[model samples]
Target chain A: MSGASRQPNGSHAGGVPHDDDGVPGPGEMGGIPRGPEAPAPRPPVIHALRDAGLAALVAAGLFVPLVGLRTDVGPAGGGLILRTRWADVAILVALVFTGRLAMNLWSAFRPAKRPRTALRAAQLTRIGTFVAPLFLGFAVLMPLLPWTTRYGLDLGVLVLTYVMLGWGLNIVVGLAGLLDLGYVAFYAVGAYTYALLSTTYGLSFWICLPLAGIFAAFAGVLLGFPVLRLRGDYLAIVTLAFGEIIRVVLLNWVSLTGGPNGISGIPRPSFFGLSFSAGGEPGSFADFFGLEPSPTHRAVFLYYLILVLALLTNWVTIRLRRQPLGRAWEALREDEIACRALGINVTNTKLTAFAIGAMFGGFAGAFFATRQAFVSPESFTFIESAIILAIVVLGGLGSQLGVAIAALVLIGGFEAFRDFEEYRMLVFGAAMVVIMVWRPRGLVSTRRPSVALGERKAISGDLVGEGHG
Target chain B: MSAPILPARNAPILQVRELLMRFGGLTAVNRVSFDAMAGDITAVIGPNGAGKTTVFNLITGFYKPSGGEIVLNGPGGPKPLHATVGHRIAQAGVARTFQNIRLFPGMTVLENLLVAQHNTLQAATFFGIGAAFGLGRYRQAEREAVALARRWLEATRLLDRADDPAGALPYGAQRRLEIARAMCTNPVLLCLDEPAAGLNPRESEELAELIQLIRAQGCSILLIEHDMGVVMRISDRVVVLDHGVKIADGTPAEVRADERVIAAYLGEGDEDDVPAAPVEGAA
Candidate 1:
């Protein structure tokens, strides 16, 4: 069977003929000619074995969380309980397969005319599509659900926070082509800024948010001045160092930051005079708003608030990408010398990109502090930067839609696999490797040329030039 | 040269006085001095590595001259133009092209031209922030940029491909497009390096005509070309360089007859050993 599979024409291998050029000449090309066809090349068994070994390793990694869970539960209770969770695994697998299949089918039958309408429809579908899993989790697939409803809502809030962070980072790394490993430092700054201001000065969340963004923008400018001449790897390393410095300062400065323990009891966003807590009065938000007295309301509100912020981020980014400053960033990315020749002040351009990107990060950070009602240095780490960068790369660098899609797949997938606690990170790492191998340029690889001085058009023909200038 | 324009009684529009540019131990341009009169085509010709491009770079501010003054008789008065960077030089009405084309490859042809006029656009008061937000001044700048880009594209006969990436054009078209992009900056002195290099015979003739047309627009052109046909046909004055020194500078006929130029082309002391390539029937 292996030999038959290896043959060029399995049943008629002996009838094939070889030409000097390796391709069949004239009669051989036209019809079956009796001769020795080229010897069928054997499959590389070692390569196949290596691939199988890697796959097994990845599979083995998925059981790590289960092992951890088993140890926690003890030998008597662990085995049977682990067996029951297999149903949840099957449901997740089915959902992922269905999503892939649906995407393929939808793309195949997509309409050609009314392109604008189609684009709008596609966008609406994208926005509304997440409702499916949520509906299934809450209403339909109850047995497959691992956690109680309360923890599920908490997972949703966490995912929303990262989604906002991803969108903010996308502005710097994706649109501006500036590698900012220190982005989380700005986030930490915002959270601490809000935390300190509200706790000491008694400012509300609403007032502190914009103030935090302003402060972060100033910090961005401070960082930008020192690294104006740096580019590529040097710039990345400097920014990484800057992030560490911010974290270290926060840790060492005992008086201002409360040292490593971080500020606590940060204020939550309130609706007018009504608080979310039950003891505020019998006719507080829960009674007057005709809602259940549960912490889920606050979680839901924070989720939607972040959703709005994320939407704003997307809108502002799209607008900014079409503006002159945005074009200047892209020009600087393509060629700094040419950008300078065009009289673009490279220093100002770099600083603006840094400031704007940091401003958005600050907004998200302020929201995060309010949402959690606490802050800490542990929350902002180098791993957070890595995850944000991974989202941008996996989404395809310099593409807004791609970044959003990447965040959904990565952050959403990570959250969805929470029940498989032992295997979750393993699965995430394996997926990243597989993705890199399959699409080295990322999920949506192609990009439009940034400068559209006139109307945009499709680029045709190959880039033909010799020697770099 | 029929009495020059601006400054002194008959001062040249641009005067390079004993300009010297050194890179560490090597001197690229050694006390090279020349004057480009207004409304004339001055050709700088030399063999490979004869420092023709170095002269152009010094004049256009790509490299800072080690010594001597580059004086430009501005609309106000005669002044020593400081050895500034490329963008500042471009703003001072001196534009240049590279020996190898240096266009923004990923930008559209129109964008390439628009970027040339970036400094000229009347931006908003607050460092272009107000304009960037789609304010009135920004809208006008956009309209003007579009119009200017279209005019140059038309001039280059590349209007149909205006939206295409600059790198996608054919070789000759790319060369012409570079000239058009420079012209969009409204430069007083256009320095073209090897404008005829790599062009076919027909394209070379067309390029000569384009240079003549630009000269007709009252813009002084300083061209470095290896093609004798282009230099002899379009140049009102030709300066010959050898070993980083000016060997000859005069009208095409006068420079062609100079024995020093012949020696530079055929090499000294071997003039009898090697037959010189017949100069293209002197245009």
Candidate 2:
């Protein structure tokens, strides 16, 4: 990481004569304070003005098309046309100019020798103790709130499903240090398993859930075996290929999967054997309980079901991290050669990581299927895998709470940007870049030791190497 | 594997008979053979690239010997390690540390020891599914593992730093932690690849004491070292290697006086009768 700070100086090294790297060294000319090359510090006002001007120029260049222009259909439905919105562009540029000027002034007047933000490990771990449960409470109580609209409940279900997926991938990418780019293959497998079994064989969603997980785990082990010898980029490429292969198979195997059209009208989960049907039908939840029938009960049931499943995933992952196999996987990530030297069966360990990670992916897939009442090839695209991978990584690998919060923030934030139309991805992408630059290891970068002897201290992420395995 | 053999007195715990390793065209270890007895600190000292570490690697199953056999006489009798799978070699009662420190830097000191005992805990956890639920047998197994790690940590004097990351320790402490980790595997034969490679005199003295302690516990040792101060003091026997073959083997004092061992250390011709080997003390 110390090596990383060099880039900041390197970017500005074109004109600046960095005598001793970037850090100002001791007085060079026999302890003299100032040399001929040194210039007196400029006034803060002038500096701020120059910076704002440059920032306005750069902002104008950056927002060339999207800023001042709006594209829409002509007055009628005749043809497409462009409408210029110069005021909006000017406002955006002015905001950038002011922001840059303020930033320049702040830096110019700030005290010297300030502490950096590198002490985040201590603060984040301290926050994790309370932040995790506080978030859980809010999530649990969300649906019951009177203000939570039906759309809000639906979005909660979506976010929780992703949270589950993020945790599942955390086992492979975060814990085991295997970069799996094709995790959605397992997701697709689960969805299709539930879809095909329920639609064709008349199995209940409950029966197919476990079966879906088993089949996906089988797929995991299958994929794991051939790629056991691969590591790093090779493993990622192969897994990415596996995900694509699954999607292609689902697309072409139309009789089994409905091609691009997908399988629909899949059964929703019941209150046990009782369906959540309206009009008080026989064996329906309302009829069995002798209560008022409302569709909200079904939505609440699904929310709680997914909440339970996500918690289960979280619970299982925490337990596994302290176990021998979990330790072996982590050790393998730390130093595979050392792991082999210690008599660990690397193949079995790696396989189990993949299987378990895929197993959860499978469960989440089943949930996605039942929730949507649909299974389509289009839904299990590379982007889903990328988003899940992004969630796992951006959450800080192996940190469960971090992954949950990251999923919520990312999914909910993505949804929040839905109104931005095509610019949503672009804006979200810029946010991700800023985040990566600020904290490359994810939001929860400091890792809590799996087990501790005394008062637990968070291990700095710098100490641990990514499990290139 | 069954535990039936009770070795005769002075028997070789590890017998390497004409082990040969060839990587493409280079003979890294060529037809070398030596015996490490039941309770001895046998040091293999040679110049750089003299196949000292190569022999350790071959014995540890990092490489399959091109020919001949390497066997360790555990409580289960002689197990041929040459043909066993790479990982099973560790299970076959042999453990080794690298020339460079290879501690899992991210893990706690105790966790490093715990990982070495994974094959044991893994079975007790029923392939670890039982562990995810914190079920019956796994809890006991993990407790036993922690106790075992505690023992090694105590032995290596790392108990105080047990909670610290392995990488955060001082260099000498990391070396000790690596040995502690290797010992946690419960090996009958321990191979130390330059165990004292980067230690100060006092630290090396402490390392020699640790080696003696490991031998006292009935685990035989095979070490590659350049530190003659350590070798001359603690090693019961020394095997000198030159260009991939064993040139001399005997008590450290006897090997120290051998002409070829001197030549290997000094090159071809004599330099006015000066002692060539950095033997502890010689004017």
Candidate 3:
């Protein structure tokens, strides 16, 4: 009412408008105006995507091959021009351009609809769109195509596993705003849980999956207790140490984990009774089912399995965010002092975030072990945690869709460039630096902060509140 | 106004018995004792660094007392109120606002009030998964929170800006929102630190009316304010602190006329020389 009437143009009451440098200044931007209705500024995404598009075009030109080159495929009777190297280079350029274009379109259109529904649909569609290509390329198209298709499908599966891992980490780092550097510890817990359970009990992957999540949740609580009082960089260091400790335990504890040699011959997931292997019964899946027995079937199934798990993770995360616990986490992140004032048990809030986040990590880890049919300390390294954290950060902290988009670009795009092994990490690192410089908050930086109660209408003079919890 | 809702014969709602707080060699609150009745406006007044805020902090569990006890007369009568930290104190029925408005800068005004009721919301049933789908008793708690927030928003005349960030509200509105947020917990005793610190005279008078309204609702108030006009206008009783010691405790007129209280303010040579105007720079 009276307060609303006193609000500055495009500025919330008590909120001083800042220049590009973030300094508050006096002007129409900071002065109280005499009006009943003043339109709020457009959301930040539109501006970000426009800037990203211009940068993408300039980067695309750098990927053009120096010499127009070609290779021949002997399998086809005719000379099939092999532009593998140029195509590989061109794909990166194309990805950047596509990512920019997609971001621009998303930003421009996002504000036209209800933010909550649009956000949910955008999240699902983004994941769905990326996943549709995998099912088509791996399951249906690969078998009909050539050997090159098989290789591409295998690489896609591998990239997807990491993407899932990154997504799980995103729930912790992105949504909860907890800096977890030892996320791989949960991954190790899941892998080991499955490996030990399947080998010792002779249980199937399906049965071990839920158990792994529970065990990892237990482990997360264990880690959370000691670091309850810690915050910021200290918490990060302790979590990093915890990750290393898990790796060291796996490596040195030979009796349980098989130590340095690592656990081998880990069983892959089976469909009901059928297994993907040679020398099965005469009328097995290949004969009785009337389908060709190929390793690709296992790869395709695993890809879809992880894909579903990833979707579940996203769904669960979105839902949890609307809950009281989610708000508590954001509140804690904003100000522990105020959170305590609200009678929120900060210790318990943090533990829940850790436990839930780790549980998802465990699910991904179990899937990883079954897919690869192997378990090793090498897979659960600090670098893995770093990459997952990077995905969360690059996507944007506290933004679920942002993390997924980040993973798709970073993990998917990086793996797609496997042929250029030496330059791959260099390119990834450079891209990260460039992204950080351009958009310090990350690519998809707009956050739909966890609102206490339900989402309310945007009142005049107020920009969207950040959810510290 | 309405008749004061006095506590039952034998016990005060909150009784601080010889509470003492020390910072190394420096004694912040020295043997301060007070009682807040069930429904009364008890104003705590003091010169700068006179341990008024420190006493509030000690009572609200922001700081542990170096000595003495804080007892909230529960159903059992004179039960020790565990003043462990800020959060536990809030759980124990004591809510407070900072001298500097400390609303979650990123959170909306309505959310600021809702967060104050966080502990009252039931936990997630069905292994925390049910919360994701928004299926739970939390819906009822949410309704209560919204209704309470709306009531305070209307009371503060901030209903139109309910969805705005608390930090985005005007300075006076921010001050009122802080009180609204504290009230959402349905606190037995509201501890407000310098609620009138930076308000204009008109806003201060409005704040005084709001405090009286809050008291009329059966809530006991412990306020630290520098505004003499507001203090005299609303406070039923006043406690004056000087150099970590209670210099005077009586009705507002009695404390105002106390020579010791007047000397404590005027005798503090350099402090009195400084401008008596409100400090307006934002935190």
Candidate 4:
């Protein structure tokens, strides 16, 4: 085909409109009258009614059996007594109708010209830069706050662990564009490595931590090799299978692992050579610091330790994003065929992303085992993997700061919902829906390009494919 | 007539001998062959479904040839590319652009070029150790990489848009940027697929000059084009293919004069069914 044929400009040389066969051409409509002038667009009353009716039906189906009718047995005679909670059913139906109506109104009134990049992206980045240190300061003082309870410090440690895991998965899913649905397997490896080593050989947490990371990274390499040729859904399925295999082995292999009951009594990290223990022992941290023995001391130490580790994860990730390997990962994510055409060793780039990401996950896992003083297969299930993946996704993929904020908000928010008991997951699902509809590209939609020609400008996340994640 | 075609002053930088590509029963390419002399612009032109792109794929190592040899003359020895993988072929000094522009849309114009120099910059990173510490050696290499990127950017007149995402640039600018990105790899041979497909007259003219500029800088170019005007103006040699077979290969003037080439382009009349000539390159 000629080059001009491909032009989108809608022009063809030496062309004339014709109606030689007496079929009226596009510009020659004479017999039919044009319809009335366009009516001003009306509010979607019918659509709202339809939506409310559908919602009401769903509400009725869900709430009718539970709230609409109730049966009770008579205490003495064994006769049946029935009671109906009509109010509960009405409340459920009303809530559904109101929610549907509100959604319709919001959609109608929402601004039409949504810019690809949010206008407030720069402002948000500036605020993030300003608030980051303060956030870190708050984290550092969280355990020391006047209202700080043991639960607060424990929660802090949990949130930090997840934040670290999110950052690790972000390297694979975000930067490198490899969809890994089995990241928790690496975490399991790290935890088990420390548990087995410490329990078998009496090695300390400090010694096993790096060793755990190495083992996890090695596991990552093993996973990377077989899945190198797979992409997108295939890669995800294979990784998910790998994670399940690891958990199943941990569950069934009772000799090395403790089976479903899990390995317990894993040692907590000591303060270098000084253990955080009771009494005035020469080698105890409390004795050396001349302080009274308190469990809070150990809790506070773990908080700082995890905080440092999470920050290290963030630091290394940020540094790598600017390095050659990091750039290669991003490039591989953007267009793999193009990356290969550019002479990048795709196998190596993918492997590095996997190994480094798993290394961080392993470190977090080691900390987890020590924090709980136990290792279990249940802790490394597919759901945990899903949560970390969700954090990376809901945090706007490659944005490091986004991952931490997402982890804290999601994990801490879930923990806060403990009061709701059975309804916690329901509320969690609703929050996820609302957040996705509100900002589909996650909380932060701007990603700073790895290198900039002039000033470093953040690109709109909408412009990026979630790296096929 | 069966003697090998050779450039007068220098041996060919790339030679394709009887390259055959088949898909099941369909032979998309049938023992098609040609040679690209060093520092010259060779154009491959054919009608739709002429297996022109299949030939390009075979040479670039995107597809393994069904049979026959594709070789690159290197300093050390002949590099048999039919056995090499796509990335290794690129690393062996052959870089190519796709028919549809495949610029890394998410990356900035500058990052696209930086990625093209992945091998060199990766070495400087010392497997990421040197970069992790911001070592002097890695930093110097990075600086050089950036400098090389800027030079190519300036050459393509895309220095102003270096910070802009490659996808956001206008179509013509993206085409130029793709060339610049390929150049950043410092390729010995640049294969461009339809570089002028969507360009206006002015842009195509600019593209012709750009090809000349790249050739003047000691690189060889092999382009696939449907635009005869572009092919006629810039190509030192033109290879004509029809129905997966090379009908003519020679200087532009020589191919323009061949009867089979004329029959291929302008549909053959009932009285003028010219038999195809053997593959030949007039150096």
Candidate with top lDDT is 2
Per-residue lDDT, model 4, residue A9, is: 14
Writing each residue's lDDT as its tens digit, candidate 1 over A1-469 gives: 0001110111111211111226555677767766878776445444444444554455445644453234235467645443235555544544544555555445445675564343453454344345434532442333234663766656666655676677787767765667888888888888899999999998988899899999888888888889887877888888999889988988889899988899999988876656788554564677778777877667666766776787677767766655566666655655666666555666777888889888888888899889888888888888888888898879776666567667778887887778989999999899999998887767655445434544344232133111111
Per-residue lDDT, model 4, residue B67, is 93
**What interface-residue Cα RMSD does candidate 4 give after superposition?**
8.4
Off by over 4 Å in 4: A1-40, A43-96, A109-119, B1-9, B268-283
Candidate order by lDDT, highest to lowest? Answer: 2, 4, 3, 1
Which regions of candidate 3 fall more than 4 Å away from where they truly are? Answer: A1-148, A278-288, A449-469, B1-6, B9-11, B74-77, B82-85, B123-129, B266-277, B280-283
RMSD of each: 12.3, 8.3, 10.9, 8.5
Q: What CAPRI class is candidate 3?
A: acceptable
**TM-score (second chain) of model 4:** 0.91
Better of 1 and 2 by TM-score: 2
Question: In model 1, which regions exceed 4 Å deviation?
Answer: A1-160, A272-274, A280-292, A419-423, A449-455, A458-469, B1-11, B74-81, B120-128, B131-133, B266-283
TM-score of each: 0.74, 0.85, 0.77, 0.88
Which model is ahead, 2 or 4, in terms of lDDT? 2
A198: Cα error in model 3, Å = 1.1
lDDT (tens digit, per residue) of candidate 2 on A1-469: 0001111110111321112335555555466655477577888799899989998999988776867878889999999999888888888999999999988988888888554343553354445676777888899999989999998998999999999999999999998999999999999999999999999998999999999999999999999999999999999999999999999999999887989999999998887799988778889999888889999889999999999999999888888888887788889889999999899989998999999999999999998899899989999999999999999888888889889988998999999999999999999999888888888999888666676566445566888778885
Compare candidates 1 and 2 on DockQ and give the better one: 2
